[model samples]
Target chain A: MHSPGDKDNGEIEALIQMMSRLPGLGPRSARRIVLHLIRRRAGQMAQLATLLASVAESSRECLACGNVTQSDICPICQDPSRATGEICVVTDVADLWALERGRAFRGRYHVLGGSLSALDEIGPEDLRIPELINRITDENVTEVILALSATVEGQTTAHYIADALAPTQVAITGLAQGVPIGGELDYLDDGTITAALRARRKF
Target chain B: MHSPGDKDNGEIEALIQMMSRLPGLGPRSARRIVLHLIRRRAGQMAQLATLLASVAESSRECLACGNVTQSDICPICQDPSRATGEICVVTDVADLWALERGRAFRGRYHVLGGSLSALDEIGPEDLRIPELINRITDENVTEVILALSATVEGQTTAHYIADALAPTQVAITGLAQGVPIGGELDYLDDGTITAALRARRKF
Candidate 1:
């Protein structure tokens, strides 16, 4: 039998459970969010439900670059203007979106989905590395910028991609390592400081 | 024209905005949650959408005590076994839920929705104060425990309720203020320490 003073029914309990599974939310925050949604069911909650349903039904991985899209070919891959010879490769769609937010890179992106992890037994075939290589020849790509993270796995994936695409004779480069725009030298890690000093330009 | 590298469509963007509006979630966490949902669209995302829709359609405020329920009266108000003649008055449903979780309160609850605030121009009519007063006579309630916060507004509301029910000859009480369980004396505020000292009891 369901308790009287606890949650109303299984539906509410199930909703809270699902919400708590989200990346940053916990049980407490999930309960608060559920209550907030319940109070605004006629307006914000209804809209959110409709949007979630539609987005779930329509969203898919872009066939070209593994980025999420509502269609087989994402807008970036279909756009002629974004077909610059440079393909900035990233580890996930989030990185692609982050670079897009910066609005610096005019070329398209290749989302690898994840880094090369020997611990997890993840290999090149698991990621979109092969598809990235195919694009180099098919799209007449000039540069393959490795915009991967500074982690060991990220560097390993970058090296593996560079080696895989060496036969294509494409101009491959990695993002410059240095202090962040507002970073303090006192808070800098040893590796970042070393990289910044070694790559220091005539300022 | 829609940007190529930004979010795929307005649905995803709208979903992110709605998620961000949730308590404890910001824009960055919302984006992360949206991406997570999109990736698991066939399973978790679809389930959440369906649950949200069903819950929104079914939920309503309990007619008696103002607790959230799927019917006219909440299960707590409906249960005859819970008619202990003690109505625990709380400032919000969240507090009621908290007390219920402790499993210490055996009686029904009266949710005031909010505490009285003179600055906010909220009066007795603004909350469920009148309904709470009616429950005292209608339910043969003996003790009305004001499980409200220790804030100025909470104390003012408690005092007003006590005065309102004074003519009825019903017993009224407030929650004892003290240092919380597992609280350290050094970290506690002066007001809490003073209250705890005044409420000292024999071990």
Candidate 2:
């Protein structure tokens, strides 16, 4: 019998292998997903294939900010109303999208594509640090908000950027570290509690 | 940044929505998968799309036992060596594939597609129960081993099948329920412990 895992079922097995390579999916879940898709082949499966092809053909990085986009420039970078003399620097497009979902930041963004990692040998040049410095003067930016993760590598990258852009004289700031909205102190981590206590402001 | 969630990025948003509908994926993970796919568009993404298309076009249910196959008859059903006069019945193709992976069951399989569910108004006609009965007689089967789940619906279906096949005078059996291999007694539930004790045999 040509079992689902058998080499004879090449396409199905290959599809499952490919799916398992995606983030948050493993071989078992990939097999289940493939089976579900196969059952709905006429509807979701066909549509998914079409969408993947189209997205693959069109999707590209925004030349200005390293954000994912269909055009050379992302919509936020192209929007005149959003050019508010402020740029929120993020470590990745996912983080940029997350900040956009909050709808609190109206300024444009600069996606570094990844954070500084000495162990991985990633440096400033490997990221968009040079472009960010150029944007400070070219775009007449007044403030730069570092909305990077609180991880050590993220902080190191933030510090490196702040030092590199020192000559540009742009006002550099970072996202506040404290208790998140609706977060309970009992469940909070030690570092978070310490940071929250140290950054206490007028209540 | 036409935010990925925005209507402007229609294809990307649609792809994420479709992916989120998969068994183990949600919106957040779907977005991550889509981003990962887009990043590897030239290679993995393209290959995945091609594989999905091919599988969707070729895959179908095995006419004999309802197992998923690329042709009308599944390989297991078509194989002469698998006609061992013993048919192992399962609730779904996933279960059938699981049994195949073990490589212990050399006989053929009968996929019921789903178990009996009174709440869902599913009846014997809805599943492949009638076809299974016909196969027992036509294939000169001697034993029917029910490899159903431990769920109430699975047990109900198994009992119903046994009663229906009683007239055929075929030997009917079920999978033994006990502590799973490598299971700790402390971690096992009450039902498993009771069944294991009742069915204890000389080691």
Candidate 3:
């Protein structure tokens, strides 16, 4: 039997360590979350565990577009109406989910898994770039929207994909750069302000 | 089959909602965490699920001390070496865990579940105060240290417990009010500075 002073709580410690590895949670937050879960073990904890297990066992990446789903093909890729001759390519499934939340794009998506990173030695072959190229020709795609971030890797990947798809004659476009929908001029960065000025339209 | 803009991802949405309810996590963080878990479903996510299930099914409050445990009694209460005639009382299991992390106290602990709250109609019967008084003679306890918070409810509970234990002939004590170990005098609150001055000891 160990005293409270002993640092040998196996299960609880393991839970905290795992939770802390999550994106937004640190060690302190993880400990607080674990304690909260323990207190609500009969209700929320049990429900969360059940949902996690279900998702873990069932959720799989779409074979066509790389979006997460309970089947071989994700719901977005499987939906026939979404094949509107346009494909929005993103770096990861999270980005895909974010686009889904916006509910403005009535098209499919291509998840690249990650951007081209020279430091990490990640290249076109490492992501779903080859799959995305094949998708353009196979699905009679008329346009491909590069919805990647404004980072160096994102730009490099977008340019590489555009050059590759040039022969296929598909209209390749990138997201417009300017002030964000709800952005204040005071908070807008210098680079964004410059881009917005240079890309001014005759409105 | 749903499109990228579809708002009917039931399972995924449910998972996000449940995760947001955890302490220190809001809806945005929950969405990020859910997407991360889904992406890592084959590894960390699966491990998390297994651990959550195991803990949810097994972890229970210690019958003797109200601390979280996997068995009837917590390790602290079961450990014969921890019968040091001193018991530190806390308002919650999280408080007990916090004290355990410090690892300076060698004695056992008693969890009160919550403090006295007249507004919420909580009294001694709502907490484990009666059990604490009974443990004095049962455990041959010589000292009862109130390690509750400095809040109004905590003080009220501490005072009530002290009065109740006055008949047991056991020494009732509260944690010292002073500047925290690493706190600076300049940044310290007026109440703490006053407490520290009143309790000043000669070198």
Candidate 4:
């Protein structure tokens, strides 16, 4: 950390080195993005710092779904109208927003936190799979939509969940979104997203 | 800012407000992202924060191309192999990375900082247009590949630049990525990216 009087080249180098470690960002890009944010600190960076600190203390995971929330339960789970007997499942929180962007889905969501990965040792216990089953009976859910990725791991996890919930007789489906050969929900366009949702067929 | 004894609500709210302002992120996504980062602070989040701080200090705009850099010139400009006499002109630093991911182009790049927009009182003077004109001759740049988005503003800026650098005798081409109507480079796949790059034609 730089002292009050030490805004020198060394300090700057240290900062850039640290920033390079961020996900989706390399050292070169990190250095660039950080500088841009800092130059606008008077208008943006300072505020980002303050928010980072505060959110650090106040936020938590949704108890029912894996969605991140400030309160014990996320807003989506709290809304009575959202309990539409259907819970769309996703890999990460980012995917949830992609669906929300089109303002289409009205049902609630159950974030898996991550997919079933044998290599990473990520199993059903690591995800919200157990909780998802419980929600089916507790919420009188009729369908469990699997809006997961089409990756090897993603499909594997989807099949596992389907088998797990087979006893409940719930209609399982996926986002017929024509998700590219290998793509995340985050990158799809609004129209593609709309089409994917509309064409969603039963799995 | 709050004293040690103050309740944490205000601090948390402040953080949410600042995060809401990030591109493609609103209060809700910001809150979730912040929460996710905090929960994994010891692992991923810690690394991200440390890196954020590091880049914040060392990162600066490349003197030659306006790309983010830790020194006078960015690595792209510094690399001898990248001097392919073709300089891809883009709207921002993000676009540069998107281009890099495609790995189809062997040329250096120029970050215009932003597009020319009269609605926001932004003009040629507001962007790096003057610098771009200067680079054509300085770098012996044979081509200026316009890889901007399909937004009305993006096209307008591209056209404006093509006209401004008319006398430079540089080949003025745009990425024919047939980029979806409103697609961004970041959202594209490597193959789609390559296709677009390969199909590029004269402006």
| Best-fitting candidate, scored by DockQ | 1
- Mind giving the per-residue lDDT tens digits that candidate 3 earns over B26-98? 8778988988898788898889989998888888888889998877787888787789998988888777776
Q: What ranking emerges by TM-score with the best candidate at the front?
A: 1, 3, 2, 4
Candidate 3 deviant stretches above 4 angstroms: A1-8, A179-203, B1-9, B179-203
Model 3: pairs clashing at backbone N, Cα or C within 3 Å: none
lDDT by residue (A1-203, candidate 1, tens digit) is 34546455568778989899999898778888999999999988888999999999999989888888887778788777888898988888887776666556778899999989999999999998989999999999988888777677887998899889989999987766574654333334556644643443321
- Best lDDT among the predictions, by candidate number: 1
Q: Give the per-residue lDDT digits (tens) of candidate 3, residues A1-203.
A: 66556433478779989999999898778988988899888888888998998888888778899987777777777788887998988888777765665565778999999989889999889998999989998999988887766667777888899898989998887766664654433234456544543443321
Which has the greatest TM-score? 1
Name the lDDT value of residue B163 in candidate 2: 92
After superposition, the stretches of candidate 1 with alpha carbons farther than 4 Å from their true spots are: A1-8, A179-203, B1-8, B179-203
lDDT order of candidates, top first? 1, 2, 3, 4
Two-chain DockQ for model 2: 0.41
Q: Cα lDDT of all candidates, in order?
A: 0.79, 0.79, 0.78, 0.75
DockQ of each: 0.48, 0.41, 0.46, 0.08
Candidate 2 per-residue lDDT over residues B1-203, each given as its tens digit: 44454425667788989899899898788988998898998888888888888888988898899988787887788787888998888888777766666566678999898879989999999999999999988999988888777667887898999999999988887766574654332334446544543443321
Q: TM-score of each candidate? A: 0.86, 0.84, 0.85, 0.54
Using TM-score as the yardstick, the better of models 2 and 3 is: 3
The global Cα lDDT (0 to 1) of model 2 is 0.79
Candidate 3 at residue A187, lDDT? 37
Question: Which of the predicted structures, 2 or 4, would earn the higher lDDT when compared with the native?
Answer: 2
